[model samples]
Target: MELTKGANAALDAGDVEITVSWRATAGSADLGPSLDVCALRLGADGKVREDADLVFFNAPSSPDGSVRHIGRTPDGAGEVVTVDTTRQPADVASIVVTATIDVVTPHLTFGGLAVSARVADLATGAELARFTPPPLGPEKALVVVELYRRGGSWKIRAVGQGYASGLAGLATDYGVDVSADEDVSAPAAPLAPTAPAAPTAAVPAAAAASAADLPSTGDPRVDMRKRLDLRKKTVQAVLTKQGIPGRQARVALALDASGSMRALYRAGTVARVVERVAAVAATMDDDGTLEVWSYATEPVALPPLRVDFLADWIPLYVRMRKATTGQGGADATLARERAARAAGWPIPNWDAIGGQNEEPKVMALILEHYERLPSPPPTLVLVLTDGGLYRDKQIAELLRRTAKLPIFWQFVGIGRARYGILEKLDTLAGRVVDNAGFFAVDDLDAIDDETLYQRILGEFPAWLRAARAAGIPL
Candidate 1:
């Protein structure tokens, strides 16, 4: 690429044009022909302009080829000549041009500063096209223009401007500039050096260890199950210590009946974990008031909360888990599960749980219940499933919406699957996520009965303290 500006005393009429050219190169080696070209230009006004072209070149005989002239044309207002390559035996070497100081607008301020600018293409409507103005002060300003291409059209993207207060400033403030009536000249002598030889390839190292070496299962449900059980027991203990009967704190065990739960059956860990948590939550109170609801595509209240409702909710959990495994993939299963969980829940509309995906929908359901349920005791939502969420924006939005709510999001990652997204929600790092103080637990496969029990017991006091700080009536 070559950009040239006619030299004249007058600055305004000085026209600038750029030409881009290319050709194939030949050499002693039997290597294929190659094309050499440059997409940079320097104006007579001490300004720089560069452009990149998606050039299509023919095959070359050798890697090291000779420089050959192709064709040229006048670019900016016919001031710069650009060459085009036709039939060259060797690859085209490069395109070169001189730089010039383009335009300087003084005594003008925008957003609190004086500005001067220029552009490679004069057709642009927006000023400040190639450069930004210098800082306001008693000094001379020098601005540089650089051009390139993006998408379909050409663009002058960067600007380097400076402000100084002495003789250097005078050169910048009123120095030699490009003239208007200057004509296009023959291509200048190529000042840039020839291309160098290509580097040889290096060998790669051996592969690393596989997933078998990892410490835990990647499934989300294992983590969810352990965390839920831990949270329930902790809440019960805290209530017992406060002299508040455990029966008084109503705990609802909402399970996702979505098809994805089926994946857990194949692993065995998810079904067993769910069964244990349900049994524990059901036996928490003597009145047998533990309600189990299953959802998928829609909510189904099971072991109904009506004092008369009694059968094991575990079987239903198992059934749902078996239905989703290895069939429609995890994402599909999770979507079904989210839909069912949302349907089975009380209060909050299904829309709040989101119309798509399990995690966001579960979050929506939690927020809805928190808002609608009458000053209920600090409720613990033990969402048991694989922590596979499909929508990132929805999760962020839900977190923001529920930031003020007194709900703790405990994500239990089950199996040997990865739960990187869930780990991000853990609040131990003092990073208040989405303005919501929620934490998560991962690696359920590693927890023992004693550790699991103690962890659940530990959550009560931490949550209670958080609730107190938030002024939530317990």
Candidate 2:
């Protein structure tokens, strides 16, 4: 359906994609306006509650992960944003999609540019609505379209509202705290989308510092400090009780994103789990950043978790997979496998990684990550899973070989499941010292932070002492 200014269309699809397109040469400059697409997640009061509510190239995903600035269209003339309405919070009454000229690319305006926006169902690739605004004059930013809730259903409207003040004005109108000097450029040099973990290197002996000496977080974002203060306190208490209050380690988190664990992911359990684990990193990591990976058949390296954007990180990555595996079982799965090989999709392959559990592959990836570090600090790897461990021999071999290394594996079983070799990590033979621990919780969300942290760090101190005694470089 084509929509004119002020006209609206009903959105029946659960997941919809918004593509804003314009003529590549529609600007006064050679590169055109250099538009940056963004979304403002607003509360019922029609204002953003926080700065994280603005999704753009810098912060690609909203805090809850309901809305994301996916990327530019292949042609470079358009940008795409995805919205999952079912996952959005009830308080989010609307999501306003806008485009602005990159502040760095000055002297460009929307004068006489032909701009159009389309809304489509992501699953079906069918256009649900389209909007073509009238030619503009001197506007540097525009609210092209908006997805809003009405009578418990979603609807999209063609806004075509012009903002002469660029991004700061549009953001300020929606309640985002924009300062004068902030860089509001679109598509700033983007970080590697694959994973947030930087090249892991061993922390030099001279550089090792206790958790107490580390700052609240390495990221300079001050708001995150206040957000993480309480949880850091809880983690500190647990570390103190475990007799390692000041000890530091490079923290790594591995999450299970298999099909069977979909329930946990959908219920918002995974996000809470990340917060609990992130608190541990905040207190115990040398740099206070949590290196992270998500695995099923293969492990996907994710962006390292920072206390600064902790609320937004979980949803952005955790829900990266599709909502369902396949409707037709084996045949459908096989067809997708073939299609994936031919399509060469740029994003992470959700279907391949969501099919089954494969621990050794991810374990190797994590192991190689830390081993590459020159003189690494003692590493604490927290592995979260909810399924069975059928590859007993492979897992045991990997653990036995790494026993002498300054690495400890803490296998946390999330739900009731058969954990074959994990239950016997304490008894595994041929290791220089006990380098692993296993614990299970039937209800992860129900567990308090203090107890969870205590149980998680229960065996780490013992392993640290033994590793030091065995002549391993501390």
Candidate 3:
């Protein structure tokens, strides 16, 4: 088989022709089948250009099949032809073609089972042609082949054959030649090459020192602050871009109610946390959903407490405070022990219910509940915890599995504890960390009402920006 091209000279917008030639052996035996041939025009960057086209030809079954016409060039300067046949004939076969085209980077591609023995001018790594030959025995066969261009050569990149023997010594035979006019303009030179030299030695040191003094790169705190600021800006941009006003930003709040939550309760911080969280939730206007939950082993839905409903909940809140105070110094540990002993649960149940416990079952429940909940208006989950014990790996895996779900997790550490786990949720500092998609506030006690409000308000925008960056829909 021989492949040739028309005059290789053309403008960047000109057309070209490609031709393939082959000979079939004279015989009454079945030559099998033929395949399609495709041509791809590429830009200088090696990406697919606008000028690419494809042509297909069927190999002849009888000696008369040897004279098959593949395709034609209407107005283009060039044409590509393919001789797709399974049986190798003893006679010489040749293809001829022309095209009226200009391609900055030109390449060829073929698909089928036939073995390609040679190619020219085309880089060995380039995808120029493809073909698939029929199977040997009675079993039906299908073959897929594609060629790609490398630095200076064309190479067969992919081949799929079912019930067919692999083509042997296939790469040694193919070639390609790109003929273009010399008049085509070359790409502009890089600016840096012609630019003047930068400052040297003493001057450079001074500039470097100035840049160094401006900011440090490795500081996590500073980095976090920048990331938070950028997140807020991005969120605002998305809201504006989506034409959703700040007041109209429909927000849903889901809080964690596992046993670990009792830590915040015992620290005399749950009420304050709820107060602050509620206050933030109220700012979303009447359009927002403020469904709350107090989950222990399971999630128990709290009424959608509106700002107006806060007055009514105040009595309930007072009763809750009195109930806790009634227990005297009974903290989360004491409460867990009481619950465990009352149920005659295993001793390990106390540890499991404590802040350091891992509750895979509870987490699964939360995930299921979240899945079932009426897609709650671009919701955000605010988990107030002391960074207690939880199935980190299981939770991380679950989160990854459901990553496509649009729920933003913002953890607020409500007590004095090492929030190392929470820090992993911050994307910037935890850049390579697996769970960096979430956010956290580690020092809730140090935050004032204004700061708390700002933090809460800030979360929506930050999360919205993150979701957008991740290509998640609102």
Which candidate comes out best when scored by lDDT?
2
**Model 2, TM vs. native:** 0.52
Candidate 2 residues 30-125, lDDT tens each?
Answer: 455468999988996568978888999999998778889998888888899999998988788888999998776667777646789989999999
- lDDT per residue for candidate 1 within 78-127, as digits (tens), equals 12222222221222222232122222323321212322233232233232
lDDT of 3 by residue, 1-474 (tens): 222110011111111122322222244132333323333322222223221121223321223342233353352222243332222132222121211111221221111112232222222323333222221121122223333222222233222222211111111111122334222211111010112224333334344322112233332223222333333344344445444545333344444444445545556456545544554454443222345554444444444544322322322321121234211243533453344344222222222222233434444555676678665345556655555634566656655665556665555655454555455544433221222233346556566454554555455665566666776655
User: Positional deviation of 323 in candidate 2, in angstroms?
Assistant: 4.0
Please report how far candidate 2 places residue 70 from its true position, in Å: 38
Worst 10 residues of 1 by lDDT: 5-14
- Model 3 has a clash total of 82
User: How much RMSD separates candidate 1 from the native structure?
Assistant: 29.2
Model 3 stretches astray by more than 4 angstroms: 1-268, 314-322, 325-366, 373-376, 418-420, 427-446, 457-459, 469-471
* Candidate 1 global CA lDDT score: 0.35
Q: Assess the local accuracy of residue 245 in candidate 1 as a C-alpha lDDT between 0 and 100.
A: 37
RMSD of 2: 18.5
Model 2: lDDT of residue 149 = 76
